[model samples]
Target: MILTKQHLQNNFAKARETNSPYVFVGIKAEGVSEVIVIPKKSFDAKEQFYMNAYSEDLTHVMNNNVMITGLSYGDADQIPNII
Candidate 1:
């Protein structure tokens, strides 16, 4: 799926309203974009730790640098970056 401005707006609003992190994973296959939004207080430390480790492993395996960006509620204009 392609990430749209509206998608960003909604997710960022959700993040701000719920005071939680808006997380999405972009897969590099057929230009597919996968978005997964976990609710507030649902992503605990253990999951976070495993996610971080998995991300690191993917980075090493793919030999690509991973970039994590923090977006404010008003920064929904970052459509290109997300796509």
Candidate 2:
């Protein structure tokens, strides 16, 4: 299903309650932008996952070079980077 901000918030809330990760795929109305959420360490992991997945082409990048940090419910930029 298509996910809005509210839908994501609600899903995150539920995920917090269950202590589980919420993972999904989203496509914006523009149709040009798409997103994919994976399990990270924080709530915003969803956005980060989207950004990391969106920012670069995986075909050229090495899999080992990619790091899956935690998620933050707020914003993807708000999360600190860790090695």
Candidate 3:
């Protein structure tokens, strides 16, 4: 069977109905079959901020319960890596 964009959409629709945090999908192309799945990981607040509503102002994060820790940037080159 040939996989089309509709197939992918159907897969996503089915995934959304399930309670699993990750979705797995398989596709066949060029006589090869491959499986794809989203990896389930602990929710990171920083990622949510960056992906959903990231802003340089950071006023929202400053005022929200976003759990900001390990903020130790005192010098120009002392910026720490955010999770």
Best by lDDT: 2
lDDT of 1 by residue, 1-83 (tens): 43333443455456656665444433343334433344345445423443444343233133244322222222334334544
Q: Which scores higher on lDDT, 1 or 2? A: 2
**lDDT scores for all predictions?**
0.39, 0.41, 0.34
lDDT of 3 by residue, 1-83 (tens): 33333443443444345533543433233444444334334223323433344223222233343321212112223232211
Candidate 2 pairs with clashing backbones: 41-70, 42-70, 42-71, 43-71, 43-72, 44-71, 44-72, 44-73, 45-71, 45-72
| RMSD in order of candidates | 9.1, 13.0, 19.4
lDDT of 2 by residue, 20-63 (tens): 65444433322243344545365676544444454232211234
Worst 10 residues of 1 by lDDT: 67-76
Colliding pairs, model 1: none
lDDT of 3 at 1: 38
Q: State the lDDT at 17 in candidate 3.
A: 53
What's the best-to-worst order under TM-score?
2, 3, 1
Q: Over the full model, what C-alpha lDDT does candidate 1 score relative to the true structure?
A: 0.39
Candidate maximizing TM-score: 2
Residue 64: error of model 3 in Å?
47
